[model samples]
Target: MLVILDLNDNNKLRIDMKKNKSSITLSSLCGIIIALSTSCSVMSKEYKTILIHGLQPQQLISASATNVEADGASYWSSYWGQVSDERIDWPSYERIEGKIATDWIWPKLKQFSEANLCDSGCVLVTHSTGDLVARYIIDNQANWLRNAGLQPLNIVATFDIAGAGGGSELADIAVSALTGAASWSFVIDQALTWWLGSDVTEAVGVLHDLKVNNARKISPVPDDRAPRLRFVADGDDFFGATKLFLKGSDDGVVASHSSCGASRVDSFGSCSRHIASDGQVGHQGNGVSGFMPNHYPMLMSDNYSHNSIRNAGHKGKVTVANYAANVGGKQVSFQTYDETTGHWFWKKQYRFVADSNRLSASELIYDAIP
Candidate 1:
């Protein structure tokens, strides 16, 4: 005989018995019951963690087409740990205008959602260009899935590490140089090496979409409800070689405006209007200066390089910030850290000062994970 057990949302258990040559042992029944009981418990809510990777040229040229968490975890695995249930891998070399989304990414997301995300809910973890990929998905997935007569994914939120959603100035320089519109310079060589492994003769494909103006044009405002939490850095691994070509403060590869999810592409110091990139006193007021709709800059570090921010082992020094959602299209302050006490003070206890508050990047990321 074949026996099966299942649990519904009501916590009620259902058993199915089917005629078969295979028999079920008493121990096996007990194990099944125990597993179901533990998994279906009211206190324990099941959730899947999904990872999306960024610009990796190597992934595009590989013999195999598909790359998943099972194939190998992303660089973020150090902090996220071995917790990825699924991964959305795409050909990084292709342009964002191509069928990369429909062919390479959407099918995997649809399958994963139907199989796991619809029931379990999921958290999206993305890095670099993956942030841009995620924004496109978040904006379109609901209507697309509904049209196909499929249930939309239950996405809790997105964690964007060194996000490039606002695009980078380096891409503009690259495209200009490759097209001969602008002369090639040392800045282009070093910047391309940092991002693509070497200086290239062509700046076609994904680089086209990564241009500062082009990226903003694609998705200026998101319609999705899921919150986008940005993790940004200011340290330049290139030692000022690539920084000169970039606008404002940068983490070698991406500028603060892009990584911080600013409303517009411009020179910016920090995520907050109240704090400068140099940790000096900055302008006051909650007025919208750098915020993208539904985008929040959660953590930042002047000591963290673009590569170091994702590695848990690095333990780079960082500062964390958060704000309440838009009420009538205006953001409100939520909490502030008191450096002396080493504790966060709520709005009611607002004692915020424009000073550098230090903490480990890993510590902040670990505390924020669901």
Candidate 2:
């Protein structure tokens, strides 16, 4: 279970690392131990790509969530079961906590990258809230990186899938449904279960941040000078078949407006991803109130997982374009992906951020860096 990446420092990852001293004991971790490059022998190694999971717990995601819904073709997460160089011990089934991001994730990331990376930096592959968490780090690089014993990290790219860009209406539903005025809908319950798999009492912080107005305060800036941020959105409503559209497009989980940051010019209040803080029950505002970005980040072949049955509802296969193919004549590890095998390459490229034309992780990680 060794996941590795081998890109140069051309990509940048903007992460959020707000300091906090909250001590949560995750009493219900379900006894899952997500190992991160555990080598018994104490030795230094070079690596390229790193893995960061999103909101869904690792135990039930990818290999596990598919069990919830399968049309028969195939279903795999972009980062599920894929070996990686670095693995963040994101709570397998709990909503994110700022302390985890700052106390554990930030330090571990810097330590791992510094100890294992070559000149070629690593590629950050994130999903859901993981994308937002990383953006928080970028938003506060000085304290998170330098104070933690390193200069700014040189990330190559970031891959965001169904990111909670402007938060979700579902958050509100998850909070009130169990006791909301409306009758308890089985569909909403199921979707919320899959989302956090925990009680509302345990989700106060997550729910607070998922609020539209609250989420906007910590949302990514319009433009960041770091990595190339590439976004992928899902179309099919996998969770409870709920067509809860934010602005216009939705994937049962996240609205397309929140994912692509587009399709909200004329649609205005009706089609925006923004959900007014105060609205009538069952009434989401025009979706334009909060931050409305105009850029739609995507891959050349169009990265929309769960849109097709062939790649499974949630899995995608991308043939890494090797700019250095002639020299190596093969897929460079850390910078490439083999669709047929669903594995990331791990060869060290010693890729550095050349001042000539070095761009941020294109430019994902959050697509905010450059």
Candidate 3:
């Protein structure tokens, strides 16, 4: 005989057994005990966190595929240390493009909810284009939750790495360079080759269409009520072009001119603000930087060139640390650590807490924890 427990609320199970009084024996009883123990082990499994990876060409190449469970726990468990389910590679961009609509993203959320993966709102950590995709899904889901009368999940925090939050200026430049009859620069051609793949002409054409048809229809985000937006650029980033791109006063390859938008709260008449990484962290360091004098690298690298900032994982870690340290507070903290010594060798903290009168408060917030 075999017994099974149904974990889902539907409360159903299937079992296979032979009913024979003469055949019942001590061996069968022992087997049942062993099976019950195994079932208990499965039911008791727990996860400390959930991590969703950024967009990639294929599922196998995605960050989630590398070390799914462990990566989630390391970067996204919680600020105060709590156990939670870690979801990875769910409804990835590769899956989205193949499906031709973003509808898949929501189903994964529903799946997580049904499975009790995110009891509290899950912390979302995304990179590059994946950041935008995730945001789109969340925004849509929030709308759905409101309509369905479901309690909104608590979004602890969002960690967007080198996100193309604002439109990419390099993308604009590439489209302009390709559309006109003007002579194409070798650098531009190489960039198209590297980033968009071999079919440079067609890729540029598609990008142009997307920008003109889709991007133009979207209104700019208002300044006062923009979403809880934060920027992590490389001082030397070339791909995103933080060095070549200039916001009103900042230089992120994507440009604050294009990236900064009205906060989501602004639409609701709520007060909010935008944040950015500190100085000495531009396109290459902690800002956005591209290689080949233009394109930004994906993560951290020692080269410290235009592309280096995006390539360094440490910068993304810094951004998350800053967000965690300042939750419910009006400050952002940043620090740099030594690999070998495992100590914070340098630190720069900022406390931008404002009072009811919109004045700076005396509360002190450190940039570096250590």
Best by TM-score: 1
Could you give me the TM-score of model 1 versus the true structure? 0.73
The residue-by-residue lDDT of candidate 2 on 150-204, one tens digit each, is 6665554554555665666676576566446445677766676655554433334
Query: Which candidate's lDDT is highest?
Result: 1
TM-score leaderboard ranking: 1, 2, 3
Better of 2 and 3 by TM-score: 2
- Write model 1 residue lDDT over 100-165, tens digit each, in one string: 687767797679757755465666878888889888888888887889888878776787888988
- The estimated TM-scores of all candidates read 0.73, 0.52, 0.46
**Candidates' C-alpha lDDT:** 0.67, 0.41, 0.34
How many pairs of residues in model 3 come into backbone collision?
A: 69
What is the lDDT, from 0 to 100, of the residue 24 in candidate 3? 33
Model 1 stretches astray by more than 4 angstroms = 1-46, 59-74, 276-288, 323-337, 340-363
Q: Deviation in angstroms for 116 in model 2?
A: 6.0
